[model samples]
Target: MLGIFDDLAAGNLAGVTESLARDVIYENPAGEQYAALPDSGVWRGREAVVEAFRRRAQLVDVLELQQRDVVAEGDRALVVTYQRIRHLLTGAEAGYEASALLSLDDEGLVRYWRVLSESAAEADVFDSDLDERLLAAVRAGDSREVGALLRRGADPNHRETATGLTTLQTAAGLGEATVVAALVAAGGDVHSADSRAGGTALHKAVQRGDLRTIRVLVEAGAFVDAVAPTTGHTPLMDALWYKWPDVVAYLLERNAGLGLHTHYGFSLREHFEYELNVNTRGKDKLLVAEQLLQTRTREDERAAGEQRLMAAVTEGDQAAVRGLLASGAAVDERFPVLNGFNDLHTPLLVASRDGHTEIVRLLLDAGADVNATEPTFGAVPLHKAVYNGHADITRILVERPGIDLDFQGATNGYSPLHDALWHGYEECARVLMAAGARTDLVGHDGKTPLDVATESFGAEHPLVRELAALG
Candidate 1:
C-alpha cells in the first residue's frame, strides 16, 4: 500500500499498480451517495479498482495528497490521508480527509483496499448548467461575462448537444475573437473538433470569413491545416467554399494545401483555370465555386500580361518590356506560346542569345533565375551568350548572383568557355576566362576547354596560348 502511494506521488500510474494484487478489491465510503463516482462505492478486481480511480481523477484534480498514521504490521495496515483537490469543471479548491485500510497478500502486494471519505461525494464536477451559461454568454457576445464564467471554471471544451460544436468552435464561428481568446486562456482545446463533422475552431472561423477570429485561434495553437473528418475539408478549403477571397488569400499566404481533395469527391484546384462558358456559382451546398474561379480569372489576366512581356523580350522592345514587367510579369513565364512568340526557353535566355543586353538586365533585375536553361539543348543563358559571341551578355551573365560559371551543358557537356572556343568566339572566351571559368573541365567527347580551343584554333593561336599559360 505504501509503495502504491509512493508511485502515485511520483505521477506514475504503472508504478501505482505494481504493489496491487491481480484480484485486488477497492471500496470508497461515499460511492453510493455520489452518482458521479464509479462502481457504486465498491470495485472488485484490480482492473475495476483502477478504472474507478481514473473516474475519480476526472471528477477532481488532486493538487496534493499527504498521508499520516501509516501503520503497517504483519498483513494489515491503516493509512490516513489529507488531500487538497480542485473541482474539474468549477475550478473550486478544497481540502478533504480520508482513511484507507489495506491487507497485504503473501507476496506483500495489496489484496484489499478500502477508503472512507463521505465529503468527497459532494465535490463539484461537470455541470451542464454552467456549460450552458458560458455558451449563452458567448452567443450574447457578452465577453466580460464570458470571461467571468471562465474564471469560475466553466469548461471551455464543453460540447453543444444540438450542434456538436465545442464552445470554442461556436465562439469562433460567431467571429468572437475576444471570446475565443478567453476560452483558450481557460484551457480551451484549440484542436478539439466538432463531434458531428470533426471540424475544428479554425474551420468554424473560416466559415464565418473572420480573419480576426482565425488569427486568434491560430495564435492559440490551433492547427491551420486541420481537416474535417466527415468532409475532408481543410480550413483553407472551407474559406474557398464560402467565397471568402480575403480568407482564401490569407490561408494561401500561410501555406495551406492547394491540391487537397474532399471526401465527397471534390478536388481543390491547384491553379486558376479559365472556364469557357460556365458560371462559377456553385449549384451544390458543399462548395460556393466563387473565389477560386475569381482568382483564376486574375491569374489568367496575369498570364496574358506575361505572354506580352515575353513577346516584348523576344522582339527586343525595351519600352514594352519595361511596362509589362512593371505591371507584374513573372520573371520566368513557363507558357509555351507567348503572344505568338514561340519559344521553349525563358525571357533571359532569349534576351541573352539575341544580344538584347538591356532586356537581359531588366529580366535579371525582375528576379529571373541566372542559371535558367533552355529545353532544346539543355543550355543555360551563359551557354547561349558565349556560343553566340555576345561578349557583353556573357559579362553580365557571369556577374549575376548564383551563376554557375563552370556548369557543363547536359547534352554536350561543354562548359561556357568550351562552347565559346568551339564556336571561335575569342571575345566571349576571353570574358569567360577573366570571370575565372575553369579551363580543365572536360566536355562530352572527353576534351578539355584547352583541348577544344587547340582543336578550334591551332596551339599558336593566342587563345590557346592563354589556356596553356594558365596550365
Candidate 2:
C-alpha cells in the first residue's frame, strides 16, 4: 500500500502500472476532474488509469501530500493522506484529507483502490478558542484571569475579527487599568489601530475620557503621536474634538505632534482656534487656545514648505512632490481649499483624483493615508480614483496595505466598489474585486455593488460576472 502511494506521489506512473494488475479498476468520484477533463473518472485497465493520471496532470499540480495514519486488517488497508492541489489555469488551491481503501492480492500487489473525499478544506480550518477566551477575560476586566490566560499561551495581541479591536484596546477604552497592564506586559501590540476607525488604544482611552487608563497606557509606551487609521486624527486632536480640557492639556504637555492635520485639513491648533471662536466660553477656551498656540512660531517655519507641496500636488507635479518632501514638508500636509473647492486637499487625495499615478506612489511612500476620507463627504482616495475612472489609480489604491476597501462615503454611504460599478468603470471594478473588495456592502439605498453593477450593465456584463464570481 505504501509503495503504491509512494509511486503515485513520485510521478512514477510506470512503477504504478507494474504494481497493479493488468485489469485493475481505478475510479475517481464523479465531478472530481470531469469539469476540466471528462475522461478522468473510472479507469477499467492499468493503461487507462495511467491515461487518467496524465489528463489530471494537465489540469493541476499536486503541491503536497502527507500520510496521516494507516490501518490494516486482513488483506485490506485504509490509508489517510492530506493533499494540497493547485489548479493550473486559475491558480486556486484546495487542500483535503483523503482516505484510500485498498484491497491487496498475493505478492503485495494492489488490485483495487477507492479514495474518499473530505468534507472540509484545509483553508477553512481555524482555531478561535484562545481568541475567545482572551476576549472574554479582557471584556470582563479580570486582570488576574487575563494574566493567567496570557501565561497559559493566549495571544496578547488577539483581535476581535469583526471589529479588529485588540484586547489592550478594549481594556483601555473600558478604563480597565489592571487589565491593560496585564495585556501590555504580555506583549500586547500597542501600535495596532482598530480596523474601522484606525485609532490605537490611546485613542480609545481618549474617547472614553479615562485619564487614569490613559496614564496606564502611556506608561506602557503607547505611541503618543499615533494617528487614526482612516481620519489621521492624533490623540491631541481626539481630545480636542471631544472637548476634554484636561486630556487635551496632558497630550499637549507630552509633546504630541503639534502640526498633524485631520482628514478635513484642520490642524490641532486650528481646530482649537475654531472651537474658541464659535463658543462663548471665556476663560477655559482662552487658556486652551493660549497653550496650544505657544508652538505656532515653530509651525510658521514649515508653512512655506506646506504651501509649495499643496500647490504642486494640486497641479499633479511629480517632480515638485519629490522636491517638497525632501525640503522638510510633512508627507500628509493638508491645506484649506477655497469654499466649494472640496474640504480636504491632501497631496495623496489630490494626486489620486487627478489620475497622477507617479505622484500617488510618491505620496503613499511618504506615509499619506490611503484610506483617509474627505471631511465633507467622507470619500477616500479610492473613491475619488474610481469616480474619475482612473483604473490604474484604483488598482494602486486597492493594493495598498490597510486601505479600507469597503468604506462607505458620507455622501450616500456608497462604497468605492459601488461608485466604480455605478460609473461604468468596469476595469476598476475588476481590480477592486480581485483585491478582495466586499461586493455585498449595502449603500444607503439598500443596494449592493452587484446590484448597482447589474442595474448599470446587464447580468451577463463583465462587471456582473466578476462580482458573481466573488460570491
| lDDT tens readout by residue for model 1, 337-416 | 22233344788888888889999999999899999876547889999898889999999989988899998888889999
Candidate 1's clash total is 0
Return the clash pairs for model 1, or none: none
Stretches off by above 4 angstroms in model 2 are 1-176, 179-212, 215-246, 250-289, 293-307, 317-319, 322-346, 357-384, 392-419, 430-452, 455-462, 465-471
> TM-scores of all models?
0.36, 0.37
Q: In terms of TM-score, which candidate is strongest?
A: 2
Worst 10 residues of 1 by lDDT: 270-279
Model 2 lDDT tens row, 1-471: 587666766767788778887777776565522223323356787788778777665656678778899999988888899778666544667778888787778767777776655333422221124456678888887777777667656787777878788878888888887888778888888888888888999999988888888887888778788878688788877777666767876776665656567787787668767766786755574566456546443444455344788778778788988998887787776654222343345778878888999989988888898987766577889999998899999878887889998899977989989999899988888888888888888999999998999998999986688778777
- Model 2: per-residue Cα lDDT at residue 93: 72
lDDT of 1: 0.78
Residue pairs of candidate 2 with colliding backbone atoms: 198-229
User: Of the candidates shown, which would achieve the greatest lDDT relative to the real structure?
Assistant: 1
